[model samples]
Target: MKPIRALSNADEVVRLLGSEGDMSPAEIAERLDIPRPSVYRLLDGLESIGLTESVPGSRARLNLRWLHLADQARESMVEWAGARELLSELVERTSQTAYLTVLRGHEAVCLEWEQGRAVGVLLLKPGRSLPLYAGAAGRTCLAFGVNVEEYLDTVTERRAYTADTLTSDAALRADVEATRRRGYVFSDEDVTDGIAAIGVPIRGSRGQLLGALSVSGIKVEYLAKRDAYLEALLDVAGRLASLNEAAIQ
Candidate 1:
């Protein structure tokens, strides 16, 4: 089915404002390749719904409505009620930043994180996201989640963030296979230089893929404690899964 032109343009407007910050309707029109008049209508519609607010310089930006929605969204994830403590525990054991990410469409969304003593330029903070081929958390989720081949078909671009980042389809598929074999991912400076991460899948009681659990830090420190970190991740992921199952029961 074909997309509705107005709705598609409106969605692009929201995404543009979100990613590029405040922008005038003309700027949005130019960026999105839509008509300036259509941009005005979209902005008006969004502002009427309190999704966008006018700032100085005739620019528009997403408003506090998103924060309210975000709060509601966070509260809805009842199964993850005690996940923060678990991530903190993982951080304590490994001295590396711990992340909990769930696959959302084509991206891995970081739902939560616990900063560690050895934290570097961590990228998987809460609310941020990564392509499924990029980070440890993303790769682990991609490997363990359903319809792996279908997901690969949707990926048109495999961007390389660093020298070690896998940009080829074969390399990504190989990494996914390796992750399935080992039950975890050992990402060595894949997303960012000097940063390494270890990832393991979190499953529910019915063996459904729930999310990914990961720890990241400086390369040498991460590699040095690789075995211990993997053990800690697996232990915490199991506990989290049990918690979710018990919640449902």
Candidate 2:
């Protein structure tokens, strides 16, 4: 059996578990092309670090204690509290539903949301997940300062939710390019019929893509005053980005 180094062995085990989910030492060894004895030793070390846990008769699973640590790291972002305050302000100003979003793997997840005075507007709640190519927030996130081709390739297998959704590679790529140039994106009856949304990317202190901020309302009301709404959306996005930068610094 080859002698296993600690860092390389631990990383190999983590990659195996992450991609293949829970598995026994023998299974991990087979997948990693490592010795079974070495795999068991690595698993023991991982369990000691609180990164993996073993079940008596079942396969070992990721401990998820590190997830708590990840959340803590996210919360340490200097701008989180200020971003929430700005979101609230934007919702109040527009009287349309507003949200703050962040990318989570192949999806966008709402981190904050506020409902305006609009009667029937959809109220997105925190933790709501959306397809990376389906909604305004997702489109904005995918288009803003990211490799459009890479993102499209990653999300190609996912189904579009609406007929108007940009599922085709060419169309989606074009949309992404346009969004990057215009600095925002608009979705009319794309995610849901009778609904319209406008979104702008929020950037962090180091110019990292924070996520997106969007305002949504009924299609009829939105279309009648599209230009005005676009301006408002851009204004809010800029303010939120600035707020995030300041808070972080």
Candidate 3:
């Protein structure tokens, strides 16, 4: 919420709109924990830049033009993050689909993904938005980068997607701490039953979290290849982070 972080907040606002569809200024301010006036000003800047649009009394949504930029951003980030080749290697090694996702506001946005020949799986499609609380991707974002308490408090929809989903505050906080300590995260049957995923946060040399690399498969398959998946994610973390800042600049 500081003035210096305005651009970062603006970037997050775009991701927020993507996750929630569309929102009023009041809704945005509430979700983002920023003042209404600041939200309005932010919205104004976005509109000026043609990233979003609002009718007088309606909720503001990302302009269609934003989609074009989003597509470009994806291509741009993949190249700089060195994620393309690494994701390919991941799928080849584990025969499970791999994903590279960025922590976007209260959700993790899929930036790039590759399919595996193992089980014909295809869940984490590009552009899909997932919760930043219940999956391996969420664990990395929560543990490594974001304001955990603020994220926990603001996110209202804690749907128990499956029997294994962790919805309690205490359980989730404990998992977050554990992820930090272990330097990785694993979610089994949390987002989807019969599927499991392992994730490692990608950090820059300066220790800033860039995003996460996760691989998912049928639970048995993932468990068998867990060690390999962790190693693959670790191998590219530095490359992704080192080039991410340059990509954005």
The lDDT for every candidate, in the order shown, is 0.87, 0.77, 0.82
TM-score per prediction, in order, is 0.92, 0.66, 0.70
TM-score, cand. 3: 0.70
Better of 1 and 2 by TM-score: 1
Give the TM-score ranking, best first. 1, 3, 2
lDDT of 2 by residue, 1-249 (tens): 334466787888886786577898888888878888878878888899899999877588788886787567657765666666776777676777888888877778887777877845553556566777877898887887457778777766867667788888888888888988887788877788778888888777677787788888887777777677677777877787777677756
Candidate 3 lDDT score at position 72: 84
Clashing pairs in 3: none
Give the lowest summed-lDDT range of ten residues in model 3: 74-83
Put down candidate 1 lDDT per residue, 1-249, tens digits, no spaces.
234877888888988887789999889988999989988988998899999999999999999899888878877899888999999899889888899999898889998888889756556687779988888988987898857778778887788889998777788789888989989999999999889999999998667899999988899987577888888999999999988777767
| Winning model by lDDT | 1
Runs in model 3 lying further than 4 Å from the true structure:
1-70, 78-81, 245-249
Q: Which regions of candidate 1 fall more than 4 Å away from where they truly are?
A: 1-5, 120-122
What's model 1's lDDT at 24?
Answer: 90
Collision pairs in model 2 = none
